[model samples]
Target chain A: MNLSRTKIGAILAAPTVVYMVIFFVVPSLILFSYSFWSSESYRVVPDFVFTNYLDSLHSAVFWKVTINAVRIGLTTAAISLVLAVPVGYYLVYVSRSQTMLYLILITWFSSYLVRIYAWRTLLGTNGVLNAVLLQLGIVDHPVDAFLFSSFAVTITLVHIYLPFCILLVTSSLSEIKPDLIDAARDLGTSSLGAFFRVIAPNAANGLAGAFMLTFILVAGDYVTPQMLGGSSGQTTGLLIADQFRKTGNWPLGAAQAFVMFVISIALYFILVSLGRATGLIVKRRTINPKGI
Target chain B: MLLRILVWAVLAFLISPLIVIVLFSFHSSPALSFPFAGFSLRWYAELFNNAQLGSAVMKSLTVAFLTSVVTLLIGTTASLAWLRLGKVGRGFIEAVSVTPIALPGLFVGVSLLVLFAQAGLQLSTLTIVISHVVIALPILIVAMKARLALFDPSLEEASRDLGASQFQTFRRVTLPLIAPTLISSAILAFAVSFDEFVVTSFVAGTETTLPMYIWSMMRRTVTPLINAISTLALLFSILILLGAWLISHVRRRSAVAARIES
Candidate 1:
C-alpha cells in the first residue's frame, strides 16, 4: 500500500525521461556527431572529419548570411525588447488587469506563418501600406523595397516576437515587487531613475533571457526570411535548412546548425557580461559575500 | 498616461495583422490592399472546395490529436513525478523537459531530421507526431507542474488510507481534482501541435499539415484563398486558446467560491 518517494518518482518519471532521452538527448548527440561526418552526393558517409566545420567556417556565403542573420536578429530583439519593456512595465506595475496580458498571450499563439503572410500583404508593392501611402499621396509610386528587404524581415520579426518578449519581460518584472519601486521613489529618485536603478538591475537576468531567447529564435528563423527577406535577407537558418532540404548534405547542414547554435550561446554570455559591465546585472557573489 | 498609451499601441500593433487578415479574407477583390471592394464568402467557398487543403486539414487534426494524447500522458506522469522527487531528480527532469523549447525550432527540426535519417525511419505524419510530442510535452509539463504544486498531498493519502489502491487513489482523488488543468493543458498541447511548422516541415517529408499547406500555397501564388485558409487556421487556434483560458478562469473562480463557502 505504501511506496517510497524514490520508487514512486522512478515509476512516474520513467516514461517521460525515457522519451526525452531517446527523442531529444540522443538526437542532439547524433546531430552533433553528424557535424563531423561527410556527405557525398546526398549520402552521409560516417567518417569522422572536420571538413564540414572547416568548410562552413571558410565559406564566404556562410559568413555573409551568418552576419546578416545576426544583424536581423539583434535589430529585431532590441526593438522588441525596447517596445516590450513599456508594455510589460504597464502590465506588471501600472495595471492590475489580466485582460491585457491575456491579449498579448493570444497574439503570441496566433499562427506564425499567418503573421508572415499578413506582413507580406501589408508590405508588398501593391499591398496595404503602399495603398495608404498612394492614397495619401505620400509617395509617387509603390515602393518595391518594402517587401523583399532586410527591413521587411526585421519589421515582421519584431511584430511576430514582440508579444512573446513582452510576456517574458512581464513575468520577469512580476518577481520584483512594486513596493521596491515605491521605496525608491520615496527616497527622492525619479520614476525613470527608479526604473533604471531599482528595476533594471533586479530584472536584468530575466530581461537578458527575454532578449537572448528572442535573438536565438529570430536568428534561427528561416521561414520569414525565405518568404519576405528576398536574396539580400538570406540568413544562416535558411542556408542551413537548404543543406538538408535542398542540398542533400546532412553533415554540412548539421555543421552550419552547430555554428549557429554556438553563436547564439556565445551571444548570450556576451550580453550577460555586457549587462554586468554596465552594472545592470549585479553579481550574486558580490551581493552575498560570505556565500550566504 | 504615456505608459498606458504605449501599452495600447503595442496591443493594437499585435492585433492589427490578424485583424487585417480576417478582414481581407472577406474581400471580394483579389487585391491585398486597403480598399475593401466588397464583402464575399467566395474565398471561404474556395477553401471548402480545395481537396488538397481539406486533406492537409484532416492530417493536421489527426496529428494534433495524437500529439495531445501522447503529451498528456507523458506530461501528467512527469508532473506527478516532479512533485514527488527530491531536488536533484526534479532538476534533472525539469532541465531535460524544458530544453527543447528553450532552443530554437530549427535546431530541434534539424536534429530530429538527422535522428530519423540516421535511424532509417521514413519521414511521415508519424514522424511529425513524434516531433510535436517533443515540443508540446514541455509546455504541458510546465503548466501541469504549476497546477500540481497547488495540489494538497494529504487528500491522496486520505484516499489511500480508505483502502483505495494507488490507481484508485489517482482515479478517484487526484484525477478529478486536476481534471480542469488536465483538460486545459491537453487543449493547449493540441493548439501548439496544430500551429507547429518549422519542426513539422523537416520531418513531414512529402506529407503536408495545414501550415505546410499554407506555406506551399504562399509560394505557388498570391491569392485571397490563402487569406481564407489562413483566417480559418487562425480562428481555429484562437478558439482553442480561448477555450483553454476560459476553462482555467472558470475553475479559478469556482475554487475561490468554494474557499469562501468553506
Candidate 2:
C-alpha cells in the first residue's frame, strides 16, 4: 500500500500536533489574551485593557527587577561561555576520547535544586568558605557578602549551566573540520589568527545561539535567584512568580512574562546584529551540496 | 598543557558542589562549616524515618514514570513523521516542538496556569503530569530525530517489496533497529521529568513533588537532613544515567559480535 508522503506525514504527526495544539499552543494564546484582561480581588475578568501592561511599565519595582535579571543573566552567560569554550575546544579538537565528554554530561544530570542548595551551604555565613577563610587568617570575620547576594546567584548559575554551554559549543565546533584550520595555517596565518579568521566566523551562529540560550534560561530562572538572592538579589522571575503564588494576580503575571519574553527576543536580534557589525560573523554564500 | 589544566579546573568546579553535599551529609554536627566534627549516619537515619519525604519521593516517581511513558508514545510517532514529512511540514513540526525548550520554563508554567484557570481545571498530580509531558516531549523528539536521521530508508522499502504491510514493516524492521535509541531516549525523558522543578512549581497547586518538599525544608531551616535528601536525589539521578550508558554499551557489544559472526 503506497501512501502519499503528505498523507503519511499527517498520519504519523497527528498525535503530537494535536497534543501540542491543545496543551501548548492554545494555552499560550489564552495566556496572551489574559495579559490584556484585568484581575479584580484575585479574580481575572475577561476584558481588553492595557492596565496590566501599562501598570507594569510604569512600576518602579518592575524596572528594578528586570534590570537585575538582565545583569545576572548577562554575567552568568558570559562566564559560562568563556569557561565552556576551552573545554569544548579540547573535547572536539584536541582529544579523541569520549570519556571526558561523558563525565562532563554526568555533572549536568546531578539534579538542579540540589546544586542550588549545595551552593547555599557552601556560601552561607557559617559555610565552608567562611570556615576556610577564618582558618587561613585571611579575615578576622566571615564575609557576609558570600551568600544572599547577586554574586552568589551569578556564580551558582555559572556552575549549574557551564556543562550545558560546553555541550552546545562542542557540537557547533565539531562542524568546523580541522582541515579548515590547517588550510588557514598553510596560508601564512598563525594558530590564533586561524582560529579568529577561520573558526570564529564559521562557528559564530552556533556560539551566539549558545550564548543567547544560556542568557534566556538564566534570566528566566526563578528558583536559583530566590534561593540565594537576598532582598537585593530579587529578579523579574521571582517578582512574576510572586504575582501568581503570593499576590494572586494571574493577568498581571502573564503581562510581565510577555514583557520579559519580548525583551529576550529583542536582545537576541541586537546581539546578532552586533556580531555581524563587528565582522565576527561572516555570511557565506556557498550552497550545501546535500541540500538539507 | 594550559588548555588541559583549564578544562580540568572547570570540571572540578562543576563537580565540587555535589561533593560538598555528599560530605556534609555525613557530618556529626548540624553545622555546614568545615573542620569536620567526625562522621555520623544520623542524617541518613532521619531520611529513612521521615514519612513526608518518603511520600514525596513516591509522588515524584509516579509523575516521572507517567511523563516518560506519554512522552515516548508521542515523541516516537512525531519523530517518525519528521523523517517522512516534506520540507515545510518537517520545519513547522520541528519549530513547534523545540519552542518549549528555547523559552523559559516559567513562561510555559504561567501560560499553563492561565490555561487551566480559564478551563476551570483543578491543579493536582494530573496537572503536574501534563506539564511534565510538555517539558519532556521536546527532549525526546530531538534525541529520537537525531537517531532516525541516520536510519536507512531502503531497508523499509525492501520489507515493503517483500509483501510486508507498512505497519508490519515498521514493527518487524524499523522498530528493532531503533529500539536501542528508544530505550535511551525514554531514560533521558525520565531523567528530565524527575529533575524538573520550575514548571512543576507553578502547575502543582497542592501536590508536592520531591523538589517542592526540599524547597519547603530549605525555607524552614538549615539541617544535615537537607544534605542527606539531596545526596539521595543526586545518587538516584547518577544511577539512572549510568543505566542508560550501560544499556547502550551492551547493545554495541552485541551488535559487534553479531557482525563478526555473520
Candidate 3:
C-alpha cells in the first residue's frame, strides 16, 4: 500500500521538524525572551524589562566592541575574497582539477583550534617570524604588536575562512558554462571583456554568499579574538560569552546576541541585493551576445 | 602564470600554520620559537599519559559518532520528505533547519543552556550530544539534500509501480544510490562535532571534550605537549579528509567508466 504524497512528506519531515523546534526554535525563543528580562547581582530576574536592551544600546563599550567585530568581519571577508577568487578561478577555468579542490577542502576539514594555535605559535614575540626577523636584523627587537593586535586576529581569520570562499566562488564559477565565455569571445569580446560581461555576473551570487558566510562567521568568532586579540582583541562574541561564563548575565548576553544577529542579517541582505542587481545587468548584456 | 603563483601563495598561507605546529611538536624546549634545539618524543608520551586528555578524546569520539548517526538518519529522512513537498513547505523546513549554523555558536550554546536549565535537566554528556546534533544537522542536511537533488524520481516510481512498498523501494532503489553521500555527510558531521568547542564550552558543565581539553591547556600555558597533541589531531584530520577525497574520486571515475560503457 502507498501513502499519499503529503502523508509521506509529513511522516518523513516530522522528526526533523519536531527536533529542530524543541532543540533550535524553542531555545531561540528562550534566548529572545531572556533579552527582555534583567540580570542583577549575577542572578537573572524573570520579570520583563528593557534594561538589557537599553544597556546594550547606550553603553559605549558595546558599540565599540560591536564596531570592532564589524571591522574584523569585513576585513576578513574582503581579504578572503581577494585571495580566494584567484584560486577559485584557477581551479574552475585554468587547472580544472578535482584534486586541487579536494586539497583545499582537506585543509578546510582540519581542526579550527589547531589552525589558530599554529598562528599563535608563528606570530608570538619569540615565535617563528620574530626569530627570523631578529636573525635578519630587520628589527632591533621582537614586534610585540604582531601577536596580540587586531591585525593578528584579522590575518588568522582570513586564513581560517579563505577555503570556504574559494569553495563558494569555485562552485559559482563552475556553473557558468564554458560555452558562454566561448560564445562571448566568438562575438569579438576580448577575454577580459568576456570575463566582466559574462563570467562575473554569473559568479556574483557565489561571491556574495561567500562574503556573507565569511562575514558572519568571522564576526561571530569568539575564539580567535580571545586567543590572539590579547588586550585589544575584544569582539562582541567574546563579550556575549563573557556574560554567560564570567558574569552570569544571561539577559545582557542574549540581547547582545540578537543585536549581532540583526547586523549580520542586514549585511547579508545588502550583499544579496547587490549580487542580484549585478546578475540582472549581466543577463541584459548577454541578451546582446551577437552585438559584442 | 600569475594566477598559478597566486594560488600557490594562498595555499602556502593556508597550510603554513599546521606545518609549523607539526614541526614544533617535537622540539626539546617548551618555547614555540624556531630553531629546534633537539628532537624528542617526550611530548608525545606526555600527551598519552595525560588521563584527562585521554578521557576527553574518548568522550569527543563518542559524541561525534552519536551526532553523525543521529543527524544522518534525521537529515536523510527530512531531505527525502523535502522532495515530496511544495516549494513553500520545503523552504520553511530548510530555513528552520539551516539557521542553526548561521547563528553564533555562543548564542546556540547559551540559549540551549538556558532551555535545558529551565526544563530542570542537568547538564552532562547527554546535553552536549543534544547541542551537537543541532550544530551537525544543517551540514548533514546540506550534503544529503545535494545528493537527493541529483536522484531521479523515475527509479523510485518504477519500483513502486512494480508493487513494492515505499520502504522496499527506498531500500532497493534510493538507499544504494545515495550511499556515498550518506557516508561522506556522516564523515563531515563527525568532523564538525569532533572539532566543536564553543557550544561544548557552554553546555559541557563539568565534562570535557578534546577541544575543551586543548583549549584549557592553551589558556593555562603553551607546552610542547599541546603541540604534540595538536600534531596528532592534525594527522587524524588529514587521514579522514584523504579517505573522503579518495572515496569521491573513485566514485567519479567509476561513474565516468559506466557512462562510456553505456
Arrange candidates, best lDDT first.
1, 2, 3
Tell me which residue pairs clash in candidate 3.
Answer: none
The global C-alpha lDDT for each of the candidates, from Candidate 1 onward, is 0.89, 0.87, 0.85
Tens-place lDDT digits, model 3, residues B168-238: 98898777677677777777888888999889999999989999999998899877787898889878877
Per model, the share of native interface contacts recovered reads 0.82, 0.76, 0.77
* lDDT, candidate 1, B100-198, per-residue tens: 867879999989998898789999988999999999998888788777879888888889789998889888877777778878999999999999999
DockQ metric for all predictions:
0.82, 0.78, 0.74
**Candidate of highest DockQ:** 1
Pick by DockQ: 1 or 2, better one: 1
Output the number of the TM-score-best candidate. 2
Report the lDDT of model 2 for residue B57: 91
Q: List candidate 3 stretches off by more than 4 Å.
A: A188-190, A269-292, B247-262
Residue A64, model 2: lDDT of 96
- lDDT tens digits, residue span A1-292, model 2: 6688578978999988888878899999999998898988887799999999999999999999999999999999999999998888888888956778777877888788889989999999989889889999998999989998999999999988888899889889999989988888998998779878878888989999999999999999988989899999989998888888856788898899999999999999999899889887767547479853
For model 2 chain A, the run of ten residues with the poorest summed lDDT: A283-292
True-structure lDDT of candidate 3: 0.85
Displacement of residue A134 (Cα, Å) in model 2 is 2.4
